[model samples]
Target: RVAHMVVEVPRWTNAKMEISLTEPLNPIKQDVKKGALRFVSNVFPHHGYIWNYGALPQTWEDPRHVDPDTGARGDNDPIDVIEIGERVAARGDVIKVKILGTLALIDEGETDWKLLAID
Candidate 1:
């Protein structure tokens, strides 16, 4: 039960990246081992994303958890987030944000949620 699961999310100490809207869908993820940035891919294009995008720390959508509404598993990754504000965050910038809400998206039989936040 995802709704009943208790996960500690670091609101002030977690690292987040502000993905550019104009840039391709290539996600620039942090290389924790080497302490560097890594370009994953330019797979999808989203024209509706109008804010700084990132993810929450210590929060994972367990792939085994199935949703009752759609009967979909998790995406096996941290919850995606988008920061809405007046400033533009640079790529790979590690910053803090406040979670506002979430949008559940069913992609390929997986429950991929996008968290809404503010800087």
Candidate 2:
């Protein structure tokens, strides 16, 4: 059996763009790190324009470059904002993004799929 129990994140989000697991009143918030988007490869396209594994526009719209964080102004993709939202909704545990970060696709072998693919 799986060591940790499984839970599911909701689809809706608050104005903060973060999803709280405790309840609608206590939505847990986290940033959309490069680790979460790493799954863009095995990603199940949400909203529109399926962002290829490494195709998410760097800095939101740098085009040729890949920047998860907009270290600069006007350097973030509106799409990434939504993708992070979906990730939050799909997740089911501790109300954190890293929950999915350490998840496994098969829970076999020496390491997990997330570790193999993202790590």
TM-score for all models, in order of appearance: 0.56, 0.17
Clashing pairs in 1: 26-41
Candidate 1 lands at a TM-score of 0.56
Best by TM-score: 1
Put down candidate 1 lDDT per residue, 38-118, tens digits, no spaces: 433433462323466666655678888997766898978777776765556655555666667878899877998987667
Give residue 30's lDDT in candidate 1 (0 to 100).
Answer: 38
Candidate 2 local distance difference test against the native: 0.26
Please state every model's RMSD to the true fold in angstroms.
10.8, 14.7
**Range of the 10 consecutive residues with the lowest summed lDDT in candidate 1:** 1-10
Residue-level lDDT of model 2, residues 1-119, one tens digit each, is: 11222222133321122333346554434435554521112224443223111111111233344323432232222112212323333333422222123222222212112211110
- lDDT scores of the candidates, listed in order: 0.57, 0.26
